[model samples]
Target: MATVTLKVEGMSCNHCKEAVEGSLKKLPGVKSAVVDLDAKTATVTYEEGAVSVDQMKKAVEDQGYDVV
Candidate 1:
């Protein structure tokens, strides 16, 4: 497993947090995803080789958030 902390933008509320977290969680090999609205970051734990940071970024962006 591998973990990554991604700086995110446009997250302002619990809904935004849930949106980002939910999107990340839906990805294959994603073990966990937590979004901090105050910090504007998403910490994701995923199986290495099953997913990539680029794929994670796209997942977040597909939900209307920016992974910076």
Candidate 2:
């Protein structure tokens, strides 16, 4: 598995973290996702060949957060 730590912006509350986590969890091959509102980041564990980091970025962006 590959783990990605993404810097995210525009998240202000627990709901924002939840939104980010939920979005990533929906992707295929995503094993887990943790969103830290304090740090404004998300760490996702996924099957390497099943998903790409670019796709993960797009997934977060689709949920209205900036993925950096």
Which residue runs of candidate 1 sit more than 4 Å off their true CA positions?
none
lDDT (10s digit) by residue, model 1, range 1-68: 99999999999899989999999999999999998888899999999999999999999999898878
lDDT of 1: 0.93
Q: Which parts of model 2 have CA positions greater than 4 angstroms off? A: none
**lDDT, candidates in the order shown:** 0.93, 0.93
Best TM-score among the predictions, by candidate number: 1
Name the lDDT of candidate 2.
Answer: 0.93
Candidate 2: Cα lDDT at 67: 89
Cα lDDT of model 2 by residue, 1-68, tens digit: 88989999999998898899999999999999999888888999999999999999999999899987
